[model samples]
Structure formats: structure tokens, C-alpha cells
Target: MNDQVELVAQAIYEAEHGVCLWEGEPARHKERFREYARNAIELLDEDIGVLLLALQEANAGARLRRSKGSVRRDPN
Candidate 1:
């Protein structure tokens, strides 16, 4: 797959096989895992922010349409 997906998969594999790779330089591995976790969290936060903005825009549009329709139908 793409580079980002590959990197995430490799990190997950390493995490799952921690027991096998823990013999040497466990501290270094732990630090790398922390980096991976931080990157993943940052990506997730960005995606959530985009989704929230889109939802808000959609809600505002729906409200505007309903208000306009009601104003047109008013007898006064």
C-alpha cells in the first residue's frame, strides 16, 4: 500500500511481536512506539476537526433552506 499505511502496519506488527524483539534495546523500541502513537493521535485529531466543520456547514445550510421555505409560505 501507500507509505503512510505501510509505516502504520509495520509499527503495529512490531508492537504485537514485542516479546520476540524485546531482547535488545527495548528502551529504543519503546520510544519509537511512543512516536508512532503521537503521530496517530495527531492525524486522528485533524480528521475529527475536518468532520466537525463539514457537519456544522451542513446543519447551517439545512436551517437556511427551512427558514426560507417558511417565509415564502407565510400569508402576511
Candidate 2:
């Protein structure tokens, strides 16, 4: 969980906070970072799902949120 969180933070920083320093065509850079951010979001969501399952198993009464009609909600 810790590793996953750190990885997500690093990716988000690279996508958003690090952009000003990158010397490249703006549109291209934005597209690239968008992809990176999307991937990182997927990773973070998966990691959170794993942790949520662990919590549910350990504490049977614990309940996680649900997505509208889907089965899960993001930890964020």
C-alpha cells in the first residue's frame, strides 16, 4: 500500500508539478503526461482495491463505498 501510494504521488508530480520544467511542444507534452497520469490513476485504483479487499477480509463488518451502478468506488 505504501509503495503504491508513493508511486502514485511520484507519477502525479511528474505529470502536473514537473511540467513547467519540461522543454517541449506544449500539446505533445500535455498528451504524454495525460497518458502517464491516466496510467498512474489506474495503478492507484487497483492498489486501493487490493487494500480494500484486505480490510474487508480482516474485518467482516467493514464496508467500502460503491460506484453508482458498478461494484466499487475509488479510495480517493
Candidate 3:
């Protein structure tokens, strides 16, 4: 991947893995990811193609990437 893609993925990994101060600490980053994922799904559904298909594709792609041990680095 290009530099921009790598950077964006690094940013996402940082966001998903937030800071923790102590043992058994609650992760505050998941909430942000959930919120952002929801908003993205909503906005894309409204402006792009069908929601169901988008969600299906997202799920399938996620599964494939995970199974292949390949992290998705966006070109954003």
C-alpha cells in the first residue's frame, strides 16, 4: 500500500486500541468505534447505494480480511 493508506490504517488502529491506565480497565475506545461505524453506515445508506447491500459487503469484506490476516488500509 501507499504511504497515505498506511497512515490512515495506523490512525484507525490507534483509535481502536485506546489508552488504558490500570488493570481490568474499561476500554473507552470501543464506544467511539461503534458510534463512528453507525454514523458511517447511516450516511452511506442515505447518500450511496442500498443499506442492506452495503452492510452485507462490509461484513463479508471484514470476514475475508480477518481470515486472511490482512488489515484493510484505506486510501483516505
Candidate 4:
């Protein structure tokens, strides 16, 4: 869809499969995963906000078109 949406989706995919450099240490790996998880959550939240705003704008435009009689309805 939108460029920003695509970027966010890619970021999410990367985050889910991210690898830690300290691969041999269990504690370090867990810590790195936790950090990545937090960042992913924030990014997801921001993306959701953007999508919601887009939805609202689209709805408003549709409503305006309907009020102006530019959008037509089916007789069936």
C-alpha cells in the first residue's frame, strides 16, 4: 500500500527475526531480544496511529462526496 506502511511492515518483520551479536550468551541474547521487542512495540503503535488517521480522512472525504451528491447509490 503506502510507502510508510510498507516500511513499517518491513521493520516489524526484521525485528521479529532479529539476531543478536552476542549469540553465545543466553543472558545477553535475551536482553537484546527484550530491547528489540520494546522498539518493535513502539513502531507498531506509531504505525497504528498513522493508519487510523488515514482511515478517518478517507471516511471524511467519502462523507463530503455523499453530501455533495457526487457519490451515487444503487437502486437495487
Candidate 5:
């Protein structure tokens, strides 16, 4: 519904329809899609909390590994 989402949606539509609105190489359009997708994800992160959940899981795994002494030591 916001500007970033709108841009991503339009890029997706163009990709599906094989249409390019920009006056550049075809690869630029693909890059635009990537940029738009990244921007959309960043914007959504504020409301989604996915990053926080991932970090929490990572931290828990690290703690469990530390508690179990599962860390590997380098052999010299």
C-alpha cells in the first residue's frame, strides 16, 4: 500500500508481463526488482519482527552450544 510496496508490485508485474518501463539495458530492470524487494523487506521488518525472532533463535542456539561444550577447538 505504501510507495515501496507499490514500486515492488509494479516491478513484479513488469517482470511477469515482460515489459520494461525504463530506458536502459534489460538487466537494469532485474536489478530494480532486487532493489525494490530489499527495500520492501527492510520496510516490513519494522512491523514483522522476523529479524528479532531469528536473532533470538541464533542466540539460544549459541547458549545451548556453550552449555553443552559443543565448541570445536583448532588442532595445531
Candidate 6:
């Protein structure tokens, strides 16, 4: 839910909407879709990287907390 990730999500939604809801011949908008696809690729690699790192850190923290809590039960 970071800003960067949100932007990426918006871009993806717009791309899907534009492609699916075009009113005219699809061939006329090939370049536009191509640009959208390219931008999506960059966003996936750049913006999502932050989210991925955040998730990794969160998972690590959760695991640490679980281990600490479970240790208290080991001797019982």
C-alpha cells in the first residue's frame, strides 16, 4: 500500500481498462497499448521492488516474533 505501489496498481488498472474498453478498431491503438505495456514493465520492476522488500522485512519480523513466543512453550 505504499505510494509507489499504488501508482503501479493504478497504471495497471488503466491499461486493462483502456485495452478492454476501446470503442474503435483495436489496431488503431497498438502504439498506445504498447506504451502502456512498457510502462507497466518498468513499474513492475521498480515500484514493486519496494513493496517486495517491505514484505520480506515484515515476514522476517513475524517469524522472529513467532520463534520468541514459541520458545516460552518449549519446556512445558
Task: Give the best candidate by lDDT.
Answer: 5
Candidate 3 lDDT, 2-63, residue by residue in tens: 33232233334445566322234345644444455555555556553464454447546756
Could you give the candidate ranking by lDDT, starting with the highest? Answer: 5, 1, 6, 4, 2, 3
Candidate 3: worst-modelled 10 consecutive residues by lDDT: 1-10
Judging by TM-score, tell me the better candidate of 1 and 6.
6
Tens digit per residue, CA lDDT, model 5, 1-76: 3544434545554557675454354666656665766675677777535644554475467569777787677888
Scanning candidate 2 in windows of ten residues, the lowest lDDT window is 58-67
RMSD of each: 17.7, 13.6, 13.2, 14.9, 12.5, 13.3
lDDT of 4 by residue, 4-70 (tens): 4433433444446663223354675555545654565466675666654654575467568778896
30: Cα error in model 3, Å: 0.6
- TM-scores of all predicted structures: 0.36, 0.31, 0.31, 0.33, 0.31, 0.37
| Steric overlap count per candidate | 0, 0, 0, 0, 0, 0
Which portions of model 4 miss their true places by more than 4 Å?
1-44, 70-76
lDDT of each: 0.54, 0.49, 0.46, 0.52, 0.57, 0.53
lDDT of 5 at 25: 43
Best candidate per TM-score, number? 6
Clashing pairs in 4: none
| Decoy 1 TM-score against native | 0.36
Tens digits of lDDT, candidate 6, 1-76? 3444433443444456754233343664544554654565576775657655665575467669878977855556
Using lDDT as the measure, name the better of candidate 4 and candidate 5.
5
RMSD of 1: 17.7
| Shift of residue 33 alpha carbon in model 2, Å | 0.5
TM-score of 6: 0.37
Tally clashes: model 4: 0
How displaced is residue 76 in candidate 2, in Å?
A: 49
lDDT of 2 at 14: 49
